[model samples]
Target: MGRVTGKRVVITGGASGMGRATAELFAREGARVAVLDAQAEPGEAVAAAIRDAGGDARFFRADVSVERSVGDAVDGAAEAFGGLDVLVNCAGIIGVDKPTHEVSEAEWDAVFAVDVKGVFFATKASVPHFLTAGGGAIVNFSSIYGLIGNDEFTPYHVAKGAVNMQTKQDAASYGRHGIRVNAVNPSTVLTPLVEGIARDFPGGLPAYEEQMTGHQSLRRLGRPLDVAYAVLFLASDEADWITGVVLPVDGGYTAR
Candidate 1:
């Protein structure tokens, strides 16, 4: 049987990037997928693609920072899937990249809103349902920047750093209840999000991609599949004994 066969998963930000990759992977593995994303077109497109591939999929529009939206999304997913087995909190935005001193209060708040607060809302909304289902797994998205430092990545790092701690706290508090909480911290993975950042950077796209590749010990930037594989393992029963851990899909970048 497939690793996630008969599992039901909810993935936030499932319209694109790592979230989209995770959703596709789960559906392909015989799981029912409910995608929560703010972008309608892409979100629907993903669901349609999954159905076309003989997988069950659904999409919901939600802004993770808002309590109501997050709550509704979680409730809707549980209603549609009969139960929830896994929750992947992958919704986040890097916000405006700038030096710490130059960062605006609004910008800081915005980054915290989606990157940190969103995870909180989504996971909290699903916790009770997970308990009802007799146990569940949660996969949160962190970043290499959370552990390391970078000149222009202040807000993103702060948000991801928070996610790491939150993951541990959730696992410790809920493990007795059969819930497993963990995090996936990845380095430079090529995605639409990364491509957009590269375009707006000082070195431009090609130069930034090269820089991302250069920073990895493997000399190649991480691919979405790399992170997806790790997440799949963590979300599966194979990781039953694992919880509150942070797995880095960093292409060995953190080792340097």
Candidate 2:
């Protein structure tokens, strides 16, 4: 239960979905959590819930695409926790469901800003803190689209691909300093973001669920906690020897 005992962890986008689940799980496992999100009320609620349960936590608001905001939030988290040991880069945005040829440049840029640049900014701000601590872990949230191709997901796929490579590059660059970098690529998790996308599909949630289920050997869509467990594993000391690897939390979808 205390796998991450006394560790100080920061989870971006931690107010909802997979990030929220990770925050709760980390707190339960004895980690002091820093919940950073753009949503104020919900973020504060998440932190408060952790504290209510006798866990240490706090909330920080920041737009990850902005360097200054990310720097300030990360710095504040470190100060609040007295030090930082783990970073879960879960802050991301889905792109317009359009083909590359049809998608607007603005759409592409926006996706990259949050999904790619956010990861970069957060990692940049965390490195020095990690160095000061002598070691740390970084678990980035990639996607199945990042590793494979699908229709109407060009921008998101591109950003996720960049994330995969960036994760590897960071791992290679910082391994000597005891900083472990890795990414978790999940498939069709039924988060609120994905739920919204499902509604946009032809037959709404049911049709989307059927399609997603058919692709999975488990015959069901993934839950946020599914991905959260994987993130927790990578962020914990159990994965101390793992780095630069992209772990897929898909239900055997990628096995085919």
Candidate 3:
């Protein structure tokens, strides 16, 4: 039950979706969780919920796109927890759905600012703490779109691709120090954000679900827990020998 027993974890975007699920699960498994998100109310709620459930947790507000904010929050979490053992880069956005040529520079930059630069900033801030601890783990949330191209969210796809490369680069650079970096590339998960997107789809939610599942070998949308479990495994000691891996959590979406 205690897969990550006593580990100190900092999860970006822990207020919602897969990030929240990962936070809750980590706490249940005996980790001291720091929920970092720009949304203070929800972030606090997530941490409070964990504490209510007899887990150690706290909320830290931070804008991941800003280097200073990320640094402060990461440091704060480490201080609060006495040290850091894991960092989960789950803060991201599904940016504008325009084609690459049609996307404005601002739009592209905005997406990269959150999806790509956020990961870079958070990882940069956590590495020293990890080194101080003698080693740690990092689980980055990439997407199937990062591994394979499609016809939507060009900027998001590109940003995640960069995340995949960064995961490999950091994994290679840090393995000698006992730090392991890996990415989880999930298919369409039915988070509140995705549910909203589905509701606004041309043919509505049912059609959106049908269309998404059509690409997956498993004929269903993913759940937050689906991706959270992958994060847990990567963060846990069971995966001590694993690093530099871009693991696909997709329900065979990439298998096709």
Candidate 4:
């Protein structure tokens, strides 16, 4: 408990799924949280819940794809929480799953806008504050699909690959400045969006789960908290020396 005590955290996509779980966990550990998302109701609800639970939390509506929106939200978080200690880039999209030849240019661009560009926008906005404070942690949500190849999901994989490389580059560039950057690559987690996707699969949710379970040595799908715990570790002081690495929270899926 209290691993991130007194830290001020800004999490994009904090309204739901892994982002929400992380926000709740960070708040529980004594961090002041700012949840940024396009979804107003759920975002505000998350903040209210945190406050009701005796944690300092607030919600700010922002679109990750827009630089100005990202900048404003980061600045707002810094202002509200006194200063930003951690920035978690959890805002992302899967886009339409299609082969490279079949995917449209617009499709590719759209995914890049949110998946890859959003990370850049958020990190870019936070870097100055981190430098001012002498240090900070950045945890980006990449995907197992980014590390490996698949016939479908070209844009998503490429964007995540870009994110992974960016994480390494940023880590190298800012390590001397006390800024640490890392990314978490998770396999398909059982979020609502993923679950809905699974329902459309050939054999539906059961078959999808079975296949996913088999892909991981742990033989189970990942929960939001599973990934959230890893994000917490990377964002916390315990990982002060850990930077420039891509950590896989894949339930051992990468081992296979």
Query: Against the true structure, whose lDDT is highest?
Result: 3
Across 1-256, the per-residue lDDT of candidate 2 in tens digits comes to 6989999998999999999999999999999999999899999999999999999999999999999998999999999988899999999999788888899989999999999999999999999999999999999999989999988678999999999999999999999999999999999999989988898999998899898879777878899999998988899999999999999999988887
Which window of 10 residues has the lowest lDDT sum in candidate 2? 212-221
Candidate 4 lDDT tens digits, 1-256: 5999999999999999999999999999999999999899999999999999999899999999999998999999998877888999998899988988899989999999999999999999999999888899999999998899977788999999999999999999999999999999999799876988898989998899897778688877899999999999999999999999899999899998
Please, what are the lDDT tens digits per residue for candidate 1 over residues 1-256? Answer: 7889999899999999889999999999999999999999999999999999999999999999999999998999999999899999998888887888989999999999999999999999999999899999999999988888888678999889999999999999999999999999999888898878778878797788687868678877677888988999999999999999988899888888
lDDT of residue 22 for candidate 4? 94
Top candidate when judged by TM-score against the true structure: 3
Give the runs in model 1 whose Cα sits over 4 Å from its true position.
201-204
Candidate 4's displacement at residue 190, Å, is 0.7
Q: What TM-score, to 2 decimals, does candidate 3 have?
A: 0.99
What TM-scores do the predictions have? 0.97, 0.98, 0.99, 0.98
| Cα TM-score of candidate 1 | 0.97
Residue 29 lDDT in model 4? 93
Counted clashes in each candidate structure:
0, 0, 0, 0
Q: Write the per-residue lDDT of candidate 3 for residues 1-256, one digit (tens) a residue.
A: 5999999999999999999999999999999999999999999999999999999999999999999999999999999989999999999989899998999999999999999999999999999999999999999999999999889999999999999999999999999999999999999999987988998999998899899999789989999999999999999999999998999988899998
CA RMSD of each candidate after superposition: 1.2, 1.0, 0.7, 1.0
Locate the minimum summed-lDDT window of 10 residues in model 1: 213-222
